[model samples]
Target: MIELSTVYFGLLGIALITYATRLSGLIVMDFFPLTKRMERALDAMTGSVFVAFVVPAFYKGDIGVKLATAAALIVMFTTKKILLALTAGVLTAVIARAVLG
Candidate 1:
């Protein structure tokens, strides 16, 4: 039989290991030389990660939430107006909640 204390310590150890592994790259990255290709790759990686997080939030979300967010993204992309896009998205969400709920 596994002791509760042992199980807790085991889980904690796993979490620490995972965190250390993820952070190791960031910690060591500065040690390396930055080439033009590496720089471009890093820039693209930022946008890719942003899209990865945002797309699922829009597509898999509730209809109202998705539509509102999509509208915001479209506006932000076309006009590059951050404030207007944010206001439109928030208003859409508020209206949707008021009407739907």
Candidate 2:
């Protein structure tokens, strides 16, 4: 059995490491002047990172998850609003799961 404190400390350590890694990237990038190419690469990287996180889940998800992803994508494309898309997706997943269950 795991103690709660152990879980909390482990999560804290992970969060700190994550923050450090992000901060290090920003610090390192500051040393170099940004070129047009670098700016484009950075812009592309954001989308790639988002896709990297989302693709695996989409691939392995069940029907509810698929529906949610579809809903989010449609909302995102139509409204171009991230927060609205996310809300639509979450609501879709909840409603889908409840109805299916």
Candidate 3:
């Protein structure tokens, strides 16, 4: 079995590499002017990336998680407040887990 410290260090390495790549992107972008097309693509890319990260887990998560995501989505749509949506999601998850389990 893998050691706990090894897994911890592996995660730290992954995080550092992720940060480095994002930082490099920012650094490189400074040298180039973003055209309208590029700006549009970047804006679309953000939503695509969000869906990529969320869709799979949303597909496979437990009932509590699904309900939490729904609650969050509703709150976000109605309030346009990220913090409140996140709070609703958390509270929904807690209540759903307790009730469902």
Candidate 4:
């Protein structure tokens, strides 16, 4: 069995890396300026990253995740409101799991 300290340190390392990545942009931007093309690429990169993370999970996840994703997509597209879409999706997954259990 792995020791608790090992797990704690591993999690700490992950947290530090995440924090550094999030802050690196601001730190570098302080001295370096972005061109319009670079800025647009950065804007698209976030969405691409989000999709990269989510798309694989959507294909592999459970029924609840599938239903929630479908509901969120439909609502978001129809209404063009992210908050409501997110709410509807989460509620759908929670209720689906509760009913299933």
Q: How many residue pairs clash in all the candidates, one count each?
A: 0, 0, 0, 0
Please provide TM-scores, in order, for all candidate models, with all chains considered together: 0.62, 0.69, 0.75, 0.70
Per-residue CA lDDT of model 3 for 4-94, tens digit only, reads: 9999999999999999988876787779877889889988998999999899989999988899999999999999999999999999999
RMSD of each: 6.2, 2.8, 2.5, 2.9
- Over 8-101, each residue of candidate 2 has an lDDT whose tens digit, in order, gives 9999999999999888767877787678898899899999999998999899998789999999999999999999998999999999999995
Q: Candidate 2 — which residues are off by over 4 angstroms?
A: 29-43
Candidates 2 and 3 compared: the better one by TM-score is 3
Q: What TM-score should be assigned to candidate 4? A: 0.70
How big is the positional error of residue 51 in model 1, measured in Å on the Cα after superposition? 0.7
Sliding window of 10 residues with minimal summed lDDT for model 1: 58-67
Candidate 3 clashes between residue pairs 3 or more apart in a chain or in different chains: none
How high a TM-score does candidate 2 get? 0.69
Report the error of model 1 at residue 68, Å.
1.3
The Cα error of candidate 2 at residue 57, in Å, is 0.3
Off by over 4 Å in 4: 79-83, 94-101
Q: Per-residue alpha-carbon lDDT of model 4 for 2-100, expressed as tens digits?
A: 999999999999999999999998898888888889999999998999999999999998888988999999999999999999999999999988897
Q: Which run of 10 residues does model 4 get worst, by summed lDDT?
A: 92-101
TM-score-superior candidate, 3 or 4: 3
Whichever of 1 and 4 has more TM-score, that candidate is 4
